[model samples]
Target chain A: MKTLETTLRSLRESGRKALVPYVVAGATPDWTHHVEAAVLGGADAVEIGIPFSDPMMDGVVIQEAGLRALERGTTFESICQELESLETEIPLVAMTYYNIFLHYGLRRTAGRLHDVGVSGAIVPDLSLEESDEWRAASGDSDIATIFLVAPSTSRTRMRTVAGLSQGFLYASARMAVTGAASDQGEGERVVSELRRVSDIPTYVGIGVSTPAQAHTTAVFSDGVIVGSALVKIILQGASPTDVESFVRSFRTALD
Target chain B: MDEINAMGQPDHRGHFGGFGGRFVPEALMPACVELEEAFRDAWSDEEFVALYHRTLREFAGRPTPVTPLPRLSQRLGLRIFAKREDLAHTGSHKINNVIGQTLLTQRMGKTRVIAETGAGQHGVATATAAARLGLGCTVFMGEVDTKRQELNVFRMELLGATVVPVTSGSKTLKDAVNEAMREWVTCVADTHYCLGSVMGPHPFPWMVREFQRVIGAEAAWQLKELGVDVPDAVVACVGGGSNAAGVFAGFAETAAQLYGVEAAGGAAVTSGSPGVLHGMRSLILQDEFGQVEEAHSISAGLDYPGIGPEHAHLADTGRATYVAVGDDEVIGAMRLLSESEGIIPALETAHAVAWMVREAGGRLPTGSTVLLNLSGRGDKDVAQVRAMLMEES
Candidate 1:
């Protein structure tokens, strides 16, 4: 399995903008196929969401998708078991609220994710000041603890987040959760702030939905993370081929 | 006594003995950090303190009397006194927290405030504060709660606040809170999230408790004035445990034993384990998979699956005890208070009354002097209680 930092850093060093697609692990019975579709769609890394019952930070679309996924009996253990069947060599990052991991036992979760070939995690609700224990435990298992930087973040904290963030820095495009957007959002500005702080593999997310938005974000962000837009497609019963096409559009825009 | 220890504050970084900490999204970390700094500065500034007290005094009605519950005390064979927070403006102790947050909102130059409410006491209080201070108010409540609490929705609207019905998740207080956090992120630059309870990330659990400690502080002095120094027990109902924490704050150093009553179905401290929710690590009612379960209660205010972080810590260290009462008992307790003392307590507050009735001679001594925090008026719950009575007959 590819390590998150090695793959993303190599992509950045080679001047190729990265494209990461996100999908809920159990949004569909064939959700793993959707992950496979992203691989086929030219994704450099994939973020898999372990659906949580109360996703405090997600917008409506993702929240609905999570409810659907959880109704189908998706759990942290269930999601990890399914990842074993995945054939992707690219680094896989799991995203969810902090409670899921804190409840699952941090070291056990980190070790299990590593065993399943997962490279990093995006526990959005875990702030930098409270991430020390998780970071150390995840780091011991070679599982990167990804941190997010927002437009509202002060420069000093941005520097702190960048210094502690392993694998990559998840740069929020705007001060909003994962959802749809009409304009390019704050992707460019936040990415620039992150760029000034350090040369970490920063990916702009939260509202990078459309192909044009992805294209714009890629111009400044080292990577563009397309989440809700792709999850919305899968939740709407898009076939693996259709899901591939959706991700391919963002991939094409990045290229 | 030194006031700081009397009303405990969290660590400089907001750790309430390993429970309360900032666990919000990075997008809100700056806002949380800013709130912490502002709270510390304002809480210490005599002018801000004076203004907070003045608003509570002249505007919201402070120093709510500590009344003796003679009839119920006679029946239960216990010496009982009730701290009448129900007499405060807006009919609940929730007004105290909102008044403080709304004032801080203006001080921070924020022009709008957003809040989450379950049964709507907090929302009504926030709307009231916002209207008084001339700030925009948007309250997020669960779609289900909005239907059941239409009057509160109308009340907020009448107060010039927009009430957005949250339709996601369980469509209840838990989901309303989720929706509120999502909304806060989008407007954190110009809005304050006026959290209702002593929950949420750092400063909130600590901050709200500080605002509410006035309840305990006043009752402590009032009891002394009544020649009752240091009651045998101090009791209050626990939702996110603001009232309990507040009252406990005044008597934590006292010899009085503190009891926080929880609805049996929503007894986080009584039956829950350590977990994270609403941006704090506390005792949360969750399934085996760590998914938080929906709390059930007759009162909308106490229908939460978690207790406040400080409550969790207090429960851990044995500084205070937590107990649970049934909905049926809460209803009976409400009626007993109404007929016995001409005081109708909110269903949420009746949990404490119910526990006192059951434990007065069982767990507690028959003649012990007990102080109960009457956290809210029963006017909002009378209709629900009426329907329940009719159904039972």
Candidate 2:
């Protein structure tokens, strides 16, 4: 597996913006197929979210997907093993909280994910001050540690986060969780400001449901992230083909 | 002295016939060991004691009085005294523990303090400590609790503490605990987990009890000055058992009969068995597979699946007799105390008053003195109490 740094370097060299597709692992019975379809639909990297009982920052759509994933008993280890079996060549990122990571030891979890060809991780709840332990434990595991930036974040904190973030900056489109509709005006401002401070690539997330929002976001950042909308599509009992079609449409809009 | 010694060994680890051990995860084992060592060292350090006492006196308003319940005593035909912890700073005994723990948090070089609260009493206390110490504070409260105790949430916020509503699990105290523990595990380097009660793992129960022991310690001295060496009985409500353990710790060596009253939501003690709930092994209502069943009680504070480990040990050693009071009985006792004594007790404390009323009617002698730990004031519980009474009426 390529390191998160290497993945970013390659993306920058090719002048190709990275596309990160987030899907709750085991949200449906055939999640493996859905993940494969996401990659085929033009996703450069994939974010496999481990479902937790209380996803405080998730919106209704993502919450439902998380609930379905949890009911399916898709544990951290199980998700990692499933990702390991995937034939997709795209970099895989595991997005979860410190609880799941804490339940599974930091080093062990990071090491296992790296062994499974996972390229990076993003823990929304893990603050920068608290990242040192995880960083040390994930040492040379070749997995990137991605951090988030909210509009409410101060310049000083953003600099600190950018310095610590190994892969890219997940610029939250709004002050709220996933699924809330994004405001393009605010998104543009946050993206522009983050670009000034963040040395790494920035990806805008939260509420970029339609192809239009993704296209608008692509102007200011390396890429746009669509989480709640994809989960919503899967929860609506859409087939893997339907999800892939939607992703392709979104990718085309961005291009 | 004999009673106190019988309650536990001379070490602080033992409290009046109950055993306290450090049962924790391997990751937290080192922190617990360090805390135990620090606590021991601090206890012997005169400077530490002096600082603790000064803060207790000036900030926490220590040495809360024992008020004689004249009207309740007249109605019940027994001498009734209330250990008035309700008058303490923050209107509850919770502040006592928070003050001590916050000081320790500073001593440990932690920059932030995190706590989990059920009814928001502990959250308010923790916020108070954080404000006084100028430290960052985060309180995890169940979403339901935040809704129910919106005033306290505002109070915590006004005190400069961030109140994070936990929407997980049953969306109550237990889930708040889980969230706080999760935060602690990740932020242990710069945060102190200010446990609300004598629950959770090892040092928390022991440490909270020591801090709360002031309740019983002051009450014992006051009772002795009044020429009552040993009261006929001492009663306290048991939620996570902090108040009961604190009050009981003082008379552990005395001949005074100790009684812990639990919420009788289908008779918790009589119907439950020894099982692990939360992080400690205690008497809990559980299924055959050891899955903990939710406990039902009108009092949110007492609506816990398990009692504290020290309470379990006290029950096991027979140092304290355990009893459960039903919701109806507790409500009746609350009314009786409010009408007769004009002191509104918390629903948790009403459980103990109910037990005293029942025992005094059929068992106690006319001249026998009974002391009840009025663990908290009923201000926070008035709305709930009114709703419960209206439902019954």
Candidate 3:
């Protein structure tokens, strides 16, 4: 599997803005198909969620998606098994809270993800200071560890997060939870600040749902991550066609 | 204590013997780290400790007398002294920790405070302390709890704190905690999350325990003054286990036994499996998939699915014994205490009383003195108890 940095760097060289889509791994019975659909729809990479019971960063939409996924018996182990069976060209980074990794044993989880051809992890709850163990584990397994920087982040801390982050710096578009509307100007400023601090590729996530929002975010950062909007589609049991169409729209917008 | 011991517990990362760690989102980590530093700095500082005691003594009415339950003790044929925490201002032991945290909030230069409440005791305490300290306060309550404890909602509002009725998952204390943590993340710059319980990520479990240790310290000292040695057993009800942990801290290094009574329907320590919930790795009621399950109890305070990591550590090492008591037993204990000693304990605290009553002759020695931490007054629960009795009739 391609590393996240390799994927983003290639996209950067092509002068093509990255279009990363997100889908919860076991949120629906046909969850894997949604990823394939996004891939078919021209996604550079995908963020797959390992559903957690208490998703503090997520808003109602993603939380409901998590509930549905968990009810369908989605677990880290199960999701890993399914992802292992998949054959995707681009990196599929796992997004989840720290408890899942902590509970599963950090080294074991990272090793399992690596074995499954997973490229990286975005543990939103694990900050730089608390990420030493996870980072070391990821390092041993060659799985990139991504860290998030919010609009509220201090410049010094932003530099610290950028230094610790491996694959890319995830700049949260706004202060609110996922699914909230992203303020374009505020988000662009955060992305610009992130670019000034880090040489790593930056990706804006949280609240970049619509084609316009995703395009606007891509204009500022290396790319944009669309989660809750895609989650809503899967929650409604939409066809892979619907998922592809959604991603294709973003792809068209970015082009 | 040296910085080594301080840093050791909930160590640099907040683990209490494989429990308690920072399990919050990255957005909240900086704040959690800052809070931990401030807590450590304040804990060792003589001035902070002195100010905390002064606030407790002069403002919140600490050094509450330890009253012997002569009538009930004689009837049960076991000596029992009730640590009258209910007599403290705000009518519960909740005020102690709230005061300490509010002071810490000010010390951190944060001018606003937020807290989660189950039964509204913590909400009232947080609101009361915030009002007294001239800090903005917002207390999140589960929508269901607002209906169950409407008076507390009013009490918080009267104290100038906004009570947000959370309409989220479970519609109870757990949801309130979720919402409070979310809000704290958005407003971490100038607000302190005055966590009502000793649960949650690092610093919270350790910080809350330090704030509440005064309960045991005073009780131990008071018992000594009364010419009574350590009680055979120190009993306190455990919800998030603040009172139990506090009282246990006093008797932790002693030969005295510690008994923690949890509401039977929500007995996390006794019935739960080891899992992470509410930012701490403690014993939690969860499914095999590690998804937290909803806990049930007539006493809202005890309706939490998780206990403090310290309590889990204490139970694991056999330093303390935890038992679950039914709602009927809590009601019976409440009535028994009210009739026998004219002290109506809160439904939450009644669980401890019920435990003592059930094990009076069985586990405890016939003449052994058992110190019960009367963690709160029952005035808020009179209506609930009356309704239950009415339903029974």
Candidate 4:
């Protein structure tokens, strides 16, 4: 399977914007199928989230989805195993916190993630200064360590993060978590600033829910990450087909 | 004088029982090492010690009395004692560590102290320290925690500290820590990371414990004066393990059985194994491949994936026995303590009181004494406690 870095580079070269879909592991009994369905629906990458008990940054929709996933006994290892069993070669990224990664030794986690065909990880809780262990452990393991840039990120820090980050920069659309409204103009300005400072491809996430929002973000960035909106679709009683159909709509919107 | 470990030799590489070590990125290593050296040098200096004691006595209201809980003792069938840290400045033991760290930050020529808080106790305490020392202070807290701890945010702001509401992942204490750590990395030149507990990487666990050791040290002196050479047991709740570590450190060489009670939502020691968490090696509730599992105690303070490195070391070395208490137990104990002792402990501390009641089985000998470190008062938890009580009723 191609790594996230390789896939991102390929996408950038091909003039093709990336499509990353986030799925809460075990949100339902058939969450595995949903992941497979997202892949089939033309997702360029998949971000699997391990549900937490007190998810402070998540909105009501994402929090509820996480709770439902946790209720179904979804665990970090279980999700990794699930990803390993998949036959598809789509690049996988785990979006989680430092605590989870810390609970798992960085080297061991990097190895296990590599074994399961994961190409990258985006730990929202890990600082660049605190990421050395992870970076070193994952250096030879073929997993890209992704970092985030917020609207409030300073230029110097942005450059530093961009320099350290592999794969792509997870540019937050606003100062809030997923499922919130995007400050379109502010997001654009931050994206432009980040583009000027960063050498890596940047993808805007955290509140781009609609086709128009995705297309709007695509104009300035290499990709747009849609999480809460997609999760909301599933949570709002949408069927798997509906989710795939919605994702296709987003893919077309970006294209 | 007894041979004191002056160079802090035991803290080499900052491992307290394979629990505390600087497992962070190389970028953060230099800063951590510098801070460790500064803390050691400052703490060892007689002048610094004098100033620390002065601040504790005048500003923080130190030497919090060891109150005999007659009603609680009578009800529990054991002589129960309370080390009233809640009476300290800002109403919690959090200030004890914050004051010491803030002073160290100033001595290190740092302009700012950045911290993460859950119940806002630490934030308020940090703000107090910043105001007293006239330094810039910034605190990162989860959005949800900010809402629950709104008054605390205002209080921090009132004290001239900027309370940045972290809107990222599960915006609680853990996420707040993430944001603070991130800020610290970027602003390491001018900032000091004021960790609230005895958790996190090497020097943090050791330093915070050293500052908080006053709790245990005073308790020991007081307990001896109260005609007890050694208590049968000492109990304290384990969030990031500061209070418990402070009290436990006093009884480490003694025969007193030390009980470190963890929130049962996801007990790091009981339900987890040795792993890296928050840039330290400690017992963590993690997956098979070592991803930290989310913790879920009713007490926000105890809802952490890992314990302090020293606590992990203590647990491993069998110096301290670790136990777990559930939400219901903690809440029940909260009411029991309030009703019996007229002291409402922070829900985090209630975990320890709850364990004593449950594990004691009403069989503690009448003469057997138990010293429970009442880490903090329950003012911050009144609303939540009331809601829980109303629900139960």
Candidate 5:
């Protein structure tokens, strides 16, 4: 399987920005359908959120989605088993809180994710200063570790995070949690600042909902990650076709 | 075990025997690092220590007197002294920790403070401290808590702090914490999360405990003056365990037995599984898959799914004995104390009183001396208690 770095590098070479759409695993029993739709909509990568009861980084929309997923008996083992059947070619990155890995045995969970076709992982709660154990566990499985750079991040810390992140640097468009509207100027400035510090492929997430916002964010970064917006659509009882069309619009805009 | 004790807690990476660590999101990392550094510097500074005590003495009322509950002690056949933390300015033990944290917030050059409150004592204390310290303050309370604790909500607003009503996820303390942390992520640059208890991440459990330790220190000196070298047992109610941890820290190495009383409806220490929640790995009410479970209690303050990590560590090491008291028992105990000693204890603190009522006669040795922490007054709980009493009648 190609690594996340290779895919982002390829997208850059092709003169196209990447589209990474996020959907919560087990949001419904057929949650895998959302991943298939995002991939079919021309997404270069996908982020599958493993539901946690207390997601401090998430807004109301994502929190509701996770609650629903948990009510449907979604477990990490169930998600991994379901991922093995996913036929998408794009790299799938698992986005979760650090406790999930700590509970599941980090090294063991990393190997399981690798076996099930997950190419990378993003633990928003695991800061760069506290990620040594996570990095070591995931490194053995050749699973790339993605780190986030926020507006509140210092320049020195930004350099450290950028240097350590294996796949790509996640640039949070705003200081707020996920699902709020992105400020175009702030989004552009954060991406520009990230670009100035490192040449690593940067994807701006958190409140990049609309095609216009995605387009504005993509102009300053290598890619854009849409999470709460897509999760909202899915939670609002949208069909798989609706999800595909929604993702396709962003793909077209990015193109 | 000896080597672990010699190394002395948290072991540099902030693990209280696999209970506490920095499990917050990446956005809060720099803020956490900054807060930890600022705490280390200010905590050791003589000026900071002197000022903190001076404020307590002058503004918040320190060295709260210990009252001997002779009637209740005679009934139970055991001698008891109540440390009167409920007599503090804000009517609870919460003010001590807030005074320290609000000062540290100023020291860190942050001008705003955010906190989550369950029973509203912490909210009232934070609002009071922020007003005194001349800083902006915001308090998040669950929608359910707001309805039950409406007077406290109004009190916080009247004290010049904004109270945000969170309507998510069971609408209780845990949800309030979730909302507060979400708000802190965005405003961490100039805002400090004035955590109400000895829980969450590294520096919090340690820092809050230190601020609260003065309670035990005061109690010990007062007890010694009364010619009591060491009480048979030192007891306090546990709700996220700030007061308990504070009081326990004083008697940790002493011969006094440490006892923590948990609400039967929310006995995380006695009936919970060890798992990670709210940035700490501690005993929590979680299912097999690690999803946090909602805890239930008539006392909103004790209605939480998780306890402080230090309490969990103490439980594991047998340094403390944890027990549970039911709602009915607490209500009866509250009435007994009020009728006998002219003290209406907060329902959270009444849990400890209830445990003593149930176990003092048979379980404890005759003539045993017990030091119980009266964590808070019952003024805020009068409306809720009245309703509960009406229901019982």
Candidate 6:
């Protein structure tokens, strides 16, 4: 199996930008269907968010979806159980708060994700200083610990995170939380900053809401991640087929 | 263990034994690093120290006298002295920390401050500090708490602060913190997150406690001056444990046995396990699946599911004893303090009083000399208490 970093690197080497969509696990009874929808809609990877009670890094849309998922009895075990039936070959990444993994036992969580075909993890609240343990645990399972570099990250810190990151470095396009409505971001500058220090694949996210926004950010970075815009569709009762078209639109815009 | 003996300041990287560390998003790393550097520099400079002292003395009305609660002491047979933080400006120990943070904000060239509040005491204090420093202030409060603490909302507005009602999650103090953190990400360039407690990532837990250390320092001196060198026990209520940590800093190395009282429904030290929340790894009320559990208390200020990281370490190391008190007992204790000593302690502080009430003759022993940190006034809780009393009657 190709590693997450190699897969993204190969995709970028072939001049194809990566497309990833984020979906909250158990937000709906058929939330897994949405991940499959994004997979079939031409996404290179799918990011699954296990519901946590307090998501300090998330904005309104993701928070609402997480709460909805929690009300539906979502848990790490349930999310992994759901992922077992996903039936997708695309790379999968798990996005969540640090406590979810910390409480579940870091090594056990990493092994569990690997068992469920998850190739990477994105824990936003876990800083680089506190990530050595999780990084080692994930490495034991050959799971990539993807790291984020924000617009406000210092020059020295940017290089360290880029080097420590196992998968592609996530470039948060703005100094804002996920699902914020505005499209104004510092994607170009941040991506260039990462490019100057490391030769890894970088994806710009956080404010990439519209297809035009995705098209614009993809011009500078290796890929673009769409979260709140797609999650909004899922939260408002959009069917799997509807989500498929939504992901396809961004895929088309990027291509 | 040795560092903990010196009042538990986290190491250079902010690890308090095994509890506290910086766990925040990448967006805020630079700000945390910058703030840590700024704080280190300002804290050691004699000029900065002088300015901090002058502000506390003149603006916050510091050196709040230690009051002898004679009537209550006689009734309980435990000679008690109350460190009257209720007399401080803004009516709480919260003002001391805010004044220091707002001053530090100006020093860092930040022109605005943002904070999260549960019952509004911290919000009011933050607003007051910002007003004094001519800085813009915004406070995020849970929508549920805003309804429960309407007067506090109005009070913050009166202090010229914009109060945003957070509606996500359980819509309480936890959600308010989430909102404040989200807001800080966007505006970190010019705004300082004047955290209301000794919680959150890194510098915040250590920095907030350093600022709040005034409570212990003042009470220690006053006690010595009053010819009591060291009390038998020193106690305070714990929410995020700021005031408890503050008062404990003075007596941690002394002969005084340190005690922290927590609301039964919100007792992180008593009922919680180590888990990460609001950026710090601390004792938190969480489900088996690692999801944070909602905390319930009559006082919104104490209605939190987690305690400060240092408190968790202290509990783990057995440096202090922590116990829980119920809402019913807290209410009774509130009335007792008010009627007996003509002092209306905030329901948050009444947890300590309630714990003493239950243990005075048993665990605490009769005639034991005790120093209590009366962390806040109850004026803001008057309406809530009245409504609750009426509902009960």
Clashes of each: 0, 7, 4, 11, 0, 0
For residue A107, give model 1's deviation from the true position in Å.
Answer: 0.9
* Model 1: residues with Cα > 4 Å off, grouped in runs: B4-7
Can you write out model 3's per-residue Cα lDDT over B1-393, one digit (the tens) per residue?
A: 432231236667787786777777767777888999999899899999999999999998889889999999997889999999999999989999999999999999999999999989999999999999999999999999999889899999999999999887778899899889888877889999999888998889888888888898899989999878888999999999998888888887778889999998899988998876778778988776667788899888899999999889888878889999998788889999999999999999999999888988888878998999999999998988888899999
Error of 3 at B217 (Å): 1.6
Q: After aligning candidate 5 to the native by TM-score, how far in Å is the CA of B132 from where it should be?
A: 2.0
Over all chains combined, what TM-score does candidate 1 have?
A: 0.98
Best by DockQ: 6
Which residue window of length 10 is worst by lDDT in model 6 chain B?
B1-10
- Stretches of candidate 3 off by over 4 Å are A77-87, A102-117, A129-142, A152-160, A185-197, A233-238, B1-9
List, residue by residue over B1-393, the lDDT tens digit for candidate 6. 123355766888798899999999999888999999999899988899889989999988888999999999998989899999999999999999999999999999999999999988999999999999999999999998899888889988998999999999988999999899999999999999999999999899999988988788889999988878999999899999999999999888898899999999999989999899998999999999999999998888889999999889888888889999999998899999999999999999998999988889787789998999999998888877889899999
Question: Quality of candidate 5's docking, in CAPRI categories?
Answer: medium
Global CA lDDT of candidate 4, please? 0.81
Please, what are the lDDT tens digits per residue for candidate 1 over residues B1-393? 246563477787687787989889988988998998898889999999899999999999897999998899999999999999999999989999999999999999999999999999999999999999999999999999999999999999999999999889999999999999999999998999999999999989999999998999899999999999999999999999998988999899988999999999999987898888989989899999989999999888889999899998888888899999998888888889999999999999999999998897887798999999999999999998898889989
Count backbone clashes in candidate 1.
0
**Model 4: what TM-score?**
0.68
Candidate 4, which segments miss by more than 4 Å at Cα?
A: A1-255, B1-11, B287-291, B361-364
Candidate 2 per-residue lDDT over residues B1-393, each given as its tens digit: 123554343244322233334333222434555666777677667887778878888988888889889888988899988999888889889998988888888888888999999889999999998999989999999898899889999999999999999876677886787677656644666788899888766667777888788888899989888777889889999888889988998998888889989888733455677643444445667554233456788888887776777777777778888888888788789889989988989989999999888988666678799889999988888888888768878
Candidate closer to the true structure by TM-score (higher is better), 3 or 4: 3
Alpha-carbon lDDT, every model: 0.90, 0.78, 0.86, 0.81, 0.88, 0.91
Task: Flag regions of model 5 displaced more than 4 Å.
Answer: A185-199, B1-9, B361-363
Tell me the deviation in Å of residue B76 in model 4.
Answer: 2.3
Kindly list the per-residue Cα lDDT of model 3 for residues A1-255, writing each as its tens digit: 137687778778899888888898888888888999999999988999898877778888888888888888899999988887788888888998877887788889889999988888998767565677888888888889988888778788888888888778788877667885746636788878877888788888878888988777777788888888888878887899999998999999988
Model 1 chain B: worst 10 consecutive residues (lDDT sum)? B1-10
User: Which lDDT tens digits does candidate 5 get at residues B144-231?
Assistant: 9999888999999999999999988878899999999999988898999999999998889988988998898889889999889889
> Whose lDDT is greatest here?
6
DockQ for every model, please. 0.90, 0.04, 0.47, 0.10, 0.65, 0.94
* By TM-score: ranked, best first: 1, 6, 5, 3, 4, 2
